[model samples]
Target: MDTRSLVQYELFGLWLLKRMALRFRCFAKDERCRGSSVIGLVCSWIETDLEGYRFGDNLIVGSMLDDLAPDTEDHQSRYTSSALDAVNAASIMLDFLKTRDVSLIKEIADLARDSVDMLAQEMISDDLTEAALENAIENHPLMVEELSLQEYLWSLAGEVAGSGDFFGDLIRANAEVEARLMK
Candidate 1:
């Protein structure tokens, strides 16, 4: 699959996890509020760490978009597609939250989980970025075979740093995810 496709998959997975984390922190973790005590450490991870990954993605892509010449708009467009996809996903979350429909959030998580599962089946290519994305999905927060949606939210949010520098953001997210996995 192309890098953009992989990014989309990752974003969807990330979105679901983020949504879950936000929900768990607000509702799922509190039994008195009808939440489960089983929400656990994963909730902490999401709140403390994994949130704002998409903002990091936007920072990198926005920087890239700014660097391109007006004539190279098409090239810039290719790079921006994934970022746009991420924005759309976030809007979906915002819409859900505006109504405060907790149960509906499950649908997003399910979609995110499904996206991760679909991505795990994708074949990796010689491209380094694609390889990195694939590796990211196959491991850490994702662990596609049996993805823990809750943990994924925290891991990605904590790990993903939406920086203005592209490579810098990638490096940061990788290092953060690596450290989180080690624990």
Candidate 2:
């Protein structure tokens, strides 16, 4: 697609994502692409879910077009068949990995080689709060103000560790003790 066309799509996607932010305030702070807003949103969803955070307790990756394409033919929208809907939704969820839709992101598994199991942990951490990410999303700034997603995750881990939540506090205390013992 031409640059102009891509920009148009991104703009439309931005509009849709921003509207989604009302429901999923977290989406308001995710990274975006100038060329494709839908892809941008999808990438953000994947990365956040991988970190264990989500908009809610329900399916972290729900219908991509629950609101976007309503009133359209049911086929292009959501399939009533739960299994097909899951398969179709999986395609959208994996679209980022398949197309490299966003640039500069290494696979989370690649970054989490040592602690890949964390991928299965429920999202009790929220270092990149909806407000903080919302700023980055709206301003198009890096969520960490840095490049390496790996470093950002660790830094975020520390923040989560210190967040006063029982789990987060325990993680933070453990890390500090480990640091002290190392020294």
Candidate 3:
């Protein structure tokens, strides 16, 4: 995949992680809520994640499509199939995450953060400017998965520097859901 597409996937994944974390925080604060409706929302979010993954995987597969010789139909098909499998896996993961409890959400968030860190390291080899590094470090709470849910989401998307608006939207959505559940 091209650098731009990779960046887009990374951004989308980050957004998804942020949203999932926010949802878990809201769920943790309320115990009275239960049953299928809430579960359904989570499931839908997972589906969205799967869709994002499909787009990512397709981009990866497309990169190899041009490398194969004109007659190499089998290889091309195999990559195409593999891309589909990745999408399916993403979908299943989404479904599983939706059904799981807050604890599982925490685990997933940790995994996602690790993945993001690894991806960043792989993608950005050059030393970041001092200011950039400082910004990342300062905003580490939101970007780091290990922090408390409230702190991470709030710091990541809350009025902190370098935070994307996506984080703020996630926080707002989470609050709205919680408010609905409380009523």
Candidate 4:
């Protein structure tokens, strides 16, 4: 791929990842109303809004990979490596949510820190470094400004962790909407 294409691809990937992370954070805070339909709607919005954006096609790399030459082991390996890194970052975040331990969250933050420690880290170039990522993870600016909003909602609902209900509602709402759209 040419340099322009590579740049486009990276930008698109970053956009998608950032969207996913934001949605995840929102779901974490508002578990009570989360459902597949809600999540689907949010995702649909992302796709639609980003459709004609500069790096939109870069978001299609996973689909394109399978069509690449099967014998191109090096190419496949590099793709796999990058994919794994993304997966690892996401996994660490998920684990932190599941545990809800401040220490664990801090640790996960550290992983992100480590990932972006290098001057050449894409997070740095993309302006999505660990500090920004942690801020996004802990507090989704688009959703609400105060952590108290989440805490209050959870308290009213008499729940701890504030994750299960919110994310469950979002996933279910998203699925419902997707199903209807497909019909």
Candidate 5:
């Protein structure tokens, strides 16, 4: 898979997991809500090969088995580590969401923003000023149409800094789904 597709997959997986976490929260509290349904949905989702479905407009061409299976079997081999990371993040986020009374979500979002900023700053380096970076990028053209790597990283940092509202996003998505179901 291409870098863009891989990113989309990771993002889509995160979004799906957040949606699932919300549903799981409902199941945990509401007696009427069937937890089995959620479990079954998760099972089906994970079991389905990457190529079995369409992610946005792009169609994945290979099975996730390609990722899960290692070329050489060893006691410690990295297979599906990326997917597992997403799953782990989702699980931890769900734990935070469960503590609705606390400010864990906000803290987590802030920490994420800070982490991204730090990483971006490290990638950008202090030696080059913003203007210098821009001048360099303008002078040197990449084959790709998009911004240079430094510019892209800087843009991402700016975006993360501007919108570090994880709790709001989750709430808004849930509210929209509820509103749609009512209709």
Candidate 6:
């Protein structure tokens, strides 16, 4: 894809991941009101199930539209299925990230290599630096705010081994999955 499309893809992916992460954190803080929001309910459901064996993205998204919506209005107007799928992917990513193994990123990167560039793929596999970590921290609020600078930096570096394509690959993978679901 061209640079503009690539940038938009990356930006959207980052935003979705951050939003999902924030939602998960919010649910973790209080798991009581599952009916409060569709995203919150989905997060709760996913967290309680097996890591990767639980509900499929399509299933969860369908449920979100059919059952989880807090109201009866046209919910599709407020959310896209693709975006919901990304949220599901981000939740899975959060689960994987809990392991603190950056090598795990390779599996995700490999899955979406076609959508990402070699340079970003290489970065995803490289070591994480304070600069990069700071950038992530700035871009992602509650997601990493709980970690000390060093902890956050090492977490992503050690998890992804410093390569830079981690998030990019994730975004691409999300798009790929959404496309497949569309078909």
TM-score top scorer = 1
When 1 and 5 are scored with lDDT, the better candidate is 1
Query: What's each prediction's TM-score?
Result: 0.30, 0.19, 0.27, 0.24, 0.24, 0.23
Candidate 1 residue 94 C-alpha distance from true site, Å: 1.1
- Cand. 3 Cα-lDDT: 0.38
Model 3: per-residue Cα lDDT over 1-183, one tens digit each: 343333233323334444443433333334222222332333455445533433223333233322311232333232232222223223333434334333333444445454344334444435889678655644564344434543444343333223355446545645653453343
Whole-model Cα lDDT per candidate? 0.40, 0.34, 0.38, 0.34, 0.34, 0.37
Sort order, TM-score high to low:
1, 3, 5, 4, 6, 2
Comparison by TM-score, 1 against 4, better one: 1
Model 5 ranges off by over 4 Å? 1-91, 128-183
Q: Which model is ahead, 1 or 3, in terms of lDDT?
A: 1
Ten contiguous residues minimizing lDDT sum, candidate 6: 110-119
1-183 in candidate 4: lDDT tens per residue? Answer: 343332232222222333333433333344332222333333343344323332223223333322321232333232233332333433433332233333433343333333233212323235678787555544443223223432332233222123355445434533543453233
> What's the lDDT for residue 167 in model 3?
47
lDDT tens readout by residue for model 2, 101-180? 43212232222221212211222244678676444443432222222433434444445433547355534544553453
Candidate 1 residue lDDT tens string, 115-156: 444434443443558668666666744444336644554345
Please write out the lDDT profile of model 6 over residues 62-147, one tens digit for every residue: 45444432231433221222233334544444444244343433333322221122223333424668678545434443323322
**What overall lDDT, based on C-alpha atoms, would model 2 receive against the true structure?**
0.34
User: Each model's number of backbone clashes?
Assistant: 7, 3, 0, 24, 0, 14
Order by lDDT, highest first:
1, 3, 6, 5, 4, 2
Measured over all alpha carbons after superposition, the RMSD of each candidate to the real structure, in angstroms, is: 18.1, 18.7, 17.8, 17.9, 17.8, 16.7
Q: Candidate 2 or 4, higher TM-score?
A: 4
- Model 5 poorest ten-residue lDDT run: 57-66
Alpha carbon lDDT at 130, candidate 6: 61
